[model samples]
Target: MSTETPTPFAARPGFVADEATGVAAHYGNPLSEQRDLAAGRALVEAGHRAVITVTGPDRLSWLDSLTSQSLKGLAPGQSSETLLLDPSGRVEHAAAVLDDGVTTWLIVEATEAEAFAQWLDRMRFLLRVEVAERPDVAVVGAFAGLQGVEALAPNGLPLVWEDGWGEVAEGGVAYADEPSHPARDWTYRETLVSRDALAELASSPVPAAGLLALEALRIAAWRPRLALEVDERSIPHELDWLRSAVHLDKGCYRGQETVAKVHNLGHPPRRLVMLHLDGSDNVLPAHGDTVSIAGTVAEAGDEGAGAPAREVGQVTSAAVHYELGPIALAVVKRSTPVDAGLVVDAQDTAVAAAQETIVPPSAGAAAGVPRMPRLGAVRR
Candidate 1:
């Protein structure tokens, strides 16, 4: 694995580089730009994400058959997300989906584009769907306010998938809203720009930002990214991703059975939480660092011999938001008390963390409303 990241924007002057999951961290001033972008006043390069195209008549239905979202009737220009899971319901891949009438676009981390395309190709099995990876189209990150970013109504608006996760979308339910949701103002979205057009866009006077700025806002909103936030044991419930990535009443798919079984009966083994890290040391914990409760193991489970607070979780995404300093997202054991004070082992020093529940311990048994069975299932 290459420890270095690719810098697509390095051609621009003042474009310093750092690694972020095999991609550039930022050009400069990630914190300041984060605030600007959060308020929808600026744009940032999302060179880390890649696009894959699925065409042919069977595109929508074929994709619906393989993933965890309702895509069969996806209208042209509609935005949604889907989870590709193993039969056991462990999250395998996540894509920000959008249909342009002629093709279905799968926006995923650059690292997974090729492999995920190969996986989809292997599953094509005589289906009319044609899977093709399109590195030609790049993702540019920004919010709603930035002018000239909207899609043209004539070309069906360039397949811009307005992020629906921050707000409740149709055929979904919310599990996080306590103490006020951080996504209340998260209008984050990504737009596809031609590789040739990037130089001009990057040179535009809008003022560029970096991944660090984006991460801060994303972590604050508790948004989970497939590259950094997931592991082999991850499931949708644990990250509270079902809000927009799932349709509880969708037709059968690969892991539908397990998806239903868990939400209805079994509780997720782990839960997602946002941590307010201690900034006293001016140190931040990186992803994969240990996150343990302050109390002893016996205090966590009353039976075992005394041990330093058991490792409850690992930091998945961490950042210093301009507004919320030193924040991170971690997946802790479901049994880890929400009110429990935790600490992050940042290499050598320990940093205190205040837990803000994203997925509560009682996060099972989904509450969905009566569905009057898809009347004619509107054709898109």
Candidate 2:
């Protein structure tokens, strides 16, 4: 493919919102656009929101022993999600770890590092491990048909790509693998590129997509993200996050007991579902909106005008898709009658909603193996 610079949004028939932010006006019905792989110019390195580096001879083994996922299998140039849990198994922080063979880099939410670092430090008495925060090494995101990779680490902050689908780097060098996967990161040496180079790279230009578009792609692909699908009360099973993150056979770690019990014997209380909204209405329900069965509205609006239009579930994240119209991902009580009609109140408008299960009923179902459950209520 030709590597010529892609057309900027300004040259296109879109309105510019402001000069400082450079946000483009998305007037065309978002639902009418095509859903396909984005192409064109590459993205710039805008520095990561948070960065944590783990060093020391016992780094790999130490981390493997503590995290919920199996870290032993990770090799250089690989990245995976791992969760840190309290003694009782509640998640403390979920992180994306990039292991480049020598050093392991963790990118996590901004608010999570202090607690995570303190926890790691508390566990690091005899082990030969070192944990440090490197705010100097900035993280950047790039898309488009970019080729080649290079790193500049004059200050010992090496930049490398964790490699999934797309090429990403800090200082011109690719870090990870091709076709970047969700939650991937690239590390680079801090000094390889100068301030001007960084600014120029940041201005390289790519489609300015908001979190909504990103969430839609993530939900459709069944990828788990924090705060949206994962909550303090949520178990990993509910989100189907185990596909790549959880290791059932791994040795005991914090919360492993609860994880095992829920996975093998008990059912998660709720399951994640994709909500296809009634596109004709153009109504998008806010998060935490009640979903109710059809025609169940109380007289005089006693239950709050939009009280979960049948209590099948609540929306976790929603966005008006340029192609899919108004789409939402929600968690519903798994025991809710699957065939029951569901609706959500979008302010004054009650929008018809349909729930499609994204996660199977049980882990046995997940493996394509058969397992029986106690029979419950049956509808005539």
Best by TM-score: 1
| Model 1 TM | 0.89
Which portions of model 1 show Cα errors greater than 4 Å?
1-8, 11-13, 20-24, 149-156, 297-307, 366-380
Pull out the clashing pairs in model 1: none
Residue 58 CA displacement from its true place in model 1, Å? 0.9
Q: Global lDDT of each model?
A: 0.82, 0.56
- Residue 179 in model 1: shift from native, Å? 7.2
lDDT of 1 by residue, 22-135 (tens): 334665677777878887887777767888999999999999999999999999888899999999888999999998888888999888888899999999999998999886
lDDT of 2: 0.56
What are the RMSDs of all candidates, in order? Answer: 7.8, 9.1
TM-scores for all predictions: 0.89, 0.70
Across residues 1-380, which tens digit of lDDT does each residue of candidate 2 receive?
01132213334343333222233223132222213212312222322235678888788888889988777667775666678876666666777777766677777654566677878888899988889866544444333343322344443545543323123221111111224333332221111233334434434433333223344544544455565666777777676665545677778888888776766567677777777789787677877776766657654656665443346667787776555567787877867666656777778777887766665454322234366555895646
